[model samples]
Target: MNIKKKSALVLSAATVMLGLYTGAAAQQIEKPLKKNTATTFAIVVDQETYNKAKQEINAYKSALEKQGLGTYIVSHQWTKPEEIKVVLQKLYSDKNRLEGAVLIGDIPIPMVMDAQRLTSAYKFDQARFGFRAAVPSDRFYDDFNLKLNFIKQDSLKAGNFYYSLAPESAPEIHPDIYTARIKAPAIKGKDKYELIRTYLSKVVAEKEQQNRLNHLMVYSGMGYASESQTAWASEQVALREQLPQLFRAGSSAKFVNSRMQGDLKQRLLTEVQREDLDLAIFHQHGESDVQVISGYPNVSFPQPSIENVRRYLRNKIQAANRKKQDVAETKKRFQATLGVPMAWMDDALTDSVVLADSLFEANGNIMMEDVDKIRSNVRMLILDNCYNGSFHKDDYMSGHYVFGSGKTIVAMANSINVLQDVWTTELIGLLQHGVRAGNWFKEQAYLETHLIGDPTFAFTAEGNTDYNELIVNKDGSDPVWKQLLKTGDADLQALALTKIFYAQGAASSSLLKDVYYSAADASTRMQAWKLLSTLNNADFKAVLKDALTDPYEYLRRRSANMAGDFGTDDLVPALVASGIEDWASKRVAYNSGNSMSFMNADLVIAQLQEYLKKPEFAGNTDIQRLIKRQEGTREKVLKEGKVMEDKKAVAKERAFDVNMLRTYTYHELVPQAIAIAADAAEDHKLRLAAVEALGWFPYSYQKDKIVALCDQLIADKNSTAQLREEAMRTKTYLLHFSAEKYQTVAKK
Candidate 1:
């Protein structure tokens, strides 16, 4: 047999071993596709769902076709993620390239593990928590570059297959096609098929009209970026540069903070109901079922403060009672700890006050039940929070927003907890140029992030560029992008830079560096920094040196993040100076402190000691506090490393502990981990974990040591299979990163 046939047979055997239903129905295209069509769209569904909602599905397909898309309906009784991926791959390779797809009804969900680097801060212990900690991702279908090793199908949940990133997979994500989920909520007393049918009709009706990206409503809730007003303000400044058309005369841009309104929940609902509202951005904490809208209310005077304390006490007492805890003891503890009067504790249990406080907290958030009551007119929503897009659950917050009595067509959110450090609005300007929602979302490159609802939806064009055509037709390697960089349009230039970076890899650093210094718009400069940091070359180091002091708060915050990863001694002086100068920005200050903890403890301490002698910083409490914090982290890491030497302790537990060193990316600990990894007497699991942890230190100054150790382990025939495998993976990652870092300068 040929190589392709042999590979197919092996894959088939693996699918059977995983218990995937191989005899299930295959994809059935609705009509013969035209080879000459410029672009194509797909609506994927299970056979039962397609059969039940055929009329509505056809109407949806017709609406897409009416908009000039070559739409196809692909129906299958899918039992494996590979089934759907195969269809998408075939469509993508067609003459009419598949631009976007929407997975409707019961399609396979891929749960990915061992690929934290592809995600924007989703790192869970797959060894301890198993399947529960795995990220439910659709990158299996969209990103062709990722090679997943199928683990198994979930024992309890059909159609949920678990896979791990193959050791040789790319370190980063760049999706080949954009995709979204349109699954109906599996809730009691509701017909899921009916829900799907009605949603399809809604999408069809909305496509008939043209909606411009003119009005934007931005809400910042509590506990996001520590409620840093500077982070909030800097985001708006970036927004202005990104969506210049929205900030022009006659367009509406309203920023509402949790502290700005007495009833923030009601204010949000009222704003979402506005017919003119095109996009609503919610930067807050969220669960699968609720959008957290408020923190403790800001109050003046002693009376309101007393009320707040009373409210908290009453809630805690009530919770204790429900848990069957000793209520008397709880109240006594609260009084003693808080120094509140016994009478106040007694008053806190007043039936009316307890009930009122409960109501206040509930009313402050937009719950899943609350979504049923609102008729939101916002065409698109970006839930910049955690678990709002958890479509794997029976019910989810983003599902409610899209499927409720609303005009909401799409929502971008995460299926798992997400990080605040991500550039959330990176390619948002593409919306103003009439790019489809999915096409723009594909550029985000986060694993847990997903687009719920219609992926092909777009706003009315506000610019001359047909971004839809450009995104679908133009290859990133095309020389035309280089020419487009000469254009004065900042957003367009940013787009060109992104394309060029993807095409040339680190070889594009010279152009990116030039743009970083020369670009007049903060948006372009910010974009340049974003792409340049990924290269990690000398230019990246130079950019970080300058950006640490750059006036842009967001840029400085990101620079601090990279400083922790790079952790070179040369950056310590500027890193400390900016940490002090940008201390007023809470997120920047937090990130700077984190970077200090990750850097060489001795170097950081020496710098702080010198700073203490300067008149400007002498006796500064903040500097003193930072010095203590860095020392404390170093001491703790040392103590943890000592535990790895304890043969009496559980080796598996020690392995888990060693694995955590990667979380801090403490370069100073790399050599210690290397020692544990190289020790033949160490437990196999512990040594393997140590080798895996070394991969996370690709940016460390001690990376060469890890590379040498990896080579030694790979060459040693006596090494255990697990140790050798992990060593090879670590070596691949370190070498690939090194190559990408310096490839641009090699030719020069």
Candidate 2:
């Protein structure tokens, strides 16, 4: 059979066996403990791609758990040889237990190749599903005695697919592999220039439609090994010449050229205007202490020399002497007087301490002064050079310094002298494709495949390569790429709903409503309503109104809950008003009733109060139960002298109630929760609870109240750790939420 047929057959057999196994172990599997039975997965990615993938994996794991799958996640970085070996060994040893493996970038391919070799040696079952970027050679399968599946597609083909799918008005083009090739002559002086131009034009067009181009930046660097000083200088000259050409026609578009020489800080400042620069690009050599300047002809000049070395030695000696002098003084003063002490051994007898100090100080000063200008503008640096993480004598170069005022997102080639230009090109292509909704890591993967024509290029951190290899976490989270692809519109409401549902089952009704409003389409709105329905009773009035006026019955039916808790009486009126009757009415009523009972309201009391003269609500069990519960609770509270404490407790409970209630509303939910808490009955305990719940909502509205509550909580002697934690969490949430909101609104 062909590969497709073989794959199908293998999958079918595996499914059948899995079913049988599950059936045989039904009793043992029935009570899948929330804990234990670790489901581990590994991913190999560069540092730049790690966070996004991790987030995506985490989200997917939660989604899977909701579907009743067990999962866990483990990550490893694979830059060093030793680290690679360790990850391979682990995968080999536990390959049988591994449900799946995902490899993310090209850097980890060699290591994965090694691990595949050891699979059979360790008796690892080849049947475990694996996903990777770079498609392994046939030898990978033959040598390991395994079956390998590769997901591959050409960029030009993908571009064609996109063209077909996009609107006709959207710069229509015929699908042809040779189109890029034919167009190459027009932009012939530079390699890949036509492709880059086409990609940029498409991106620019998309950005114009979206009215923003702040999300992505391209990094193009020196492509290969520097053979000599002349070759390096030539590369820099070529880069500088080409940069002006690339920017010639796209002057309106912002660009960050990586061709400048000297300190990164100075180069960045010179090439990029402060206000115009949204992203940065770096194209040079990097080691532990220094990044190469493209224009700098000689690497030897950039390398530190022994000049001013004696000062470092003298500084080291002074530091040691101070430490020794303090040893004889009082602990506090002595410790304080160590004068920015260095970390090293001190032996006064042989002046070893002085010698060591001098050497360290000398080295630091020399390196620091040489690169001071570059360091200043190297904000958000993306190192395209190899071995960027290597050590400089005693200290590491890559992770040593903070980015100062700006956030740093670095993409380093971990292997010694590895060419990152191919990876960089692929990254640019993927960015143009807009895969994973522009998620940085997923984009990296898509870019990798386009560049290398491989599906298993693993992107991971230095030591966590194995963890990165696993597409799904042990928790069964979806791959980062999948999540980003799903987030097509960057819907904040949907994201918030997901986060709340995963964290706390109940969200606010107002919040859900806001999500519905924010939705660009009926389907998205329906999805929001469906999620809302899961957490609380469906609002029948709202459902019927939307059903009659909105064009989607899917949303209407989705809004129909099988349970009732509160305010369900409103459904029948809504249905009647909408002219829906008979079976539909009956279904709506049934679903409404099913939904209302969970709201904890005295529906019976309202019914009795309304129909006492007619006796219509006399026998309503729901009404009776609600009335009894409310009255009993109220009577108990009034009779007890511990009203203060009870009131606070009730406030807290009510706060939770409001929080749960607001899960239905997408935008107004948090504010409503806070409002409910604020309006809660005057019991101090109740007030406190309400205040605490308000803190949990995104800190957008009622800032004054939130601030006052936090202050009060801090001062209150009665506050417990739980209350304090809630207060602190609210403050933090508000700070972050406000910042995000400001940035989003500012863009608008």
Candidate 3:
């Protein structure tokens, strides 16, 4: 059939199948409809797999529509695990009308998992289907009540397909293969693709010899074989037949094969000599040390034996040398001979030992046997598989087993479960397309930008990627990950401001401020202030002002917290003049009781005095009690000069300097005692004695200052904010009293 005719037939068949499937599905549903709306069935896949999966899904949707069941297909390109959540949330929120979802490949698995969580939170009943590699159903099954299904594709099916199609006269296929064996039930679509490719290769080769056919075209070929030499051969023949004059008559015909597996070294060598093949393509599981090839039953070639791998490597190296070339050069030459660039497509292999070890150590379990191997061979590994990145520190390493200093990069999914294979393929395809289009590194950055929409989603380095010259600028500034890691004092602090910003319900303003206070980096401190401006609280005003003048310009521009719910009384005039108007101005008001806990006594006294001047406070019984208690405590402290014996008389006397007590009222005596407690004397005994004497004052008035001073001493700072605030309060009180006296004299 012509290409156009074939496409039409495929589309028609797909539409028919979708209709039938939808009709059958509608008949099976007995539940009452909550609403009549078209439901979206979204699938996340790699770009290459997208066209195929989308075609199938669209067909399914069309079929369903025919049966009067609403269905729409939402497709997303998967580059990162978090992209799953992002796309799902958008679909769920916008489409609130989805009844069921079908996830294909790795990116969709995490999204579906999160969707299950969201459904439980929202109390919605939704069915989910997962298609790709198998997942551990136990984690979400009970909570989500999920009905799960998987496509199991392994090495065994790949091996059997290769063996069945091999020339009968070739070496006898091994029946008891140990490493390349894969357990059935094999992946449905994959098996069909393998069978079709094997059949086409034989047919095309025979026809070319007898009839001297210029070209051949093959259709319905999928999976690994679609990228192989057989497909390439068919394409070359078809092209030659169509464009006779465009090509030189004597030009050598080239064949390009993709997705080749099982003993690649041997297979490529054999084809290069016997079939005069120029390029070989293989895709399967791969790691730093070995590549997995399919074998009989459940076995795979190139198992994790170092000696066996070394021997294979040695042979290949020797073969290349004898051919007077390097391996990469030889591979390139082979491709050139075949007239097509060899393309090997497969997901990056994650080291099982690394994953298991990482998980075991994260949970505080120790597996000592695999530590050495993991450190040595598993560098620059990408866990394109699902759930591989979920392992924490204890899961793989105990404190005793230190990771080696090696050039390795390990990227994996943070969530638990294997991601669908399609996501990996799509990411690789995007990367390849981008590189071929002359924007290699920018593509990775673009992927990251799309995945982590906010500054909070960090792209950090592990192993060699951490040390890449590309990561560090010429000035030797720390990389992004290093900067992020050092932003907060602890993991919880880091989460509150950084990672938590991407996920909702993960942080609060007060918690974020605490993180800011502890943060050493000026940039991070500014970030905290920016986050605080979004909240309706007065506590952040002073801190925000401090950050605006911070040495870092990045901090100054971003940390403008002038507005947003801050109390007018608390906001300094200097802060108001800074021209920061991006936030709200309605501050969270606090009463005396609330202020007492968080504020120092000086601040509390100042506020109380202001309240007492008001008609409401003047008539209140609680205000009267608070005033009487303050008076009684002050009188008692004055009468009994040194209440505690711990303080030496001379030290106590020196601490209570009369000049410090500007207020004559008994309440003013408390500040004198507080000042004494914080005095740093030469003798430790005298310091303790002075501290004891200060204890005689009302604890409420003196407690905050003493604690603040102690904290300052520990931090090795000159004084605490509490001390400065108290001094300012004392200065204000003296000025107010002097003005009142002057006014009285003037009136007389």
Question: For each candidate, what is the lDDT?
Answer: 0.83, 0.33, 0.30
The digit string of per-residue lDDT tens for model 3 on 508-558 reads: 455556757776544345446544543424445556656545544334333
Better of 2 and 3 by lDDT: 2
Itemize residue pairs with steric clashes in candidate 1: none
Q: What is the per-residue lDDT of model 1 for residues 1-748, given as tens digits with 9 covering 90 to 100? A: 8999996675344221223245854456664233355688888899899999988998898788877788778777877888778878888988888888999999989999877767777778766687888898999889998899999999899878999778777666778899999998754567999989988999999999978899999998888887888888988987887888788899989998887748889889999999889999999999999999996787888998887788788888888988999999999998899999877768556788777878988987899877778887899999999999999998999998888777988999899998887777877888888889998898785999999999999998876667777777886677778787887667778888988776677778898999999997777888898887667678878998899877777888889888888888899988888778787898888888889888878888889888899998889999999999988988987877677667777776577678887687878678778988998988776788789888888778888899999999988988987788778778777766653544653210
Off by over 4 Å in 2: 1-522, 527-604, 607-708, 714-725, 731-748
Q: 2 or 3, which is superior by TM-score?
A: 2
Across 634-682, the per-residue lDDT of candidate 2 in tens digits comes to 4443333232224455544443443333222112233443443344245
Output the number of the lDDT-best candidate.
1
lDDT of 3: 0.30
Residue 572, candidate 2: C-alpha displacement in angstroms: 14
Where does model 3 exceed 4 Å of error?
Answer: 1-460, 463-493, 496-511, 559-572, 576-748
Candidate number that wins on TM-score, 1 or 2: 1
Candidate 1 structure, TM-score to reference: 0.93
Stretches > 4 Å off in candidate 1: 1-25, 32-35, 648-653, 739-748
lDDT of 3 at 511: 53
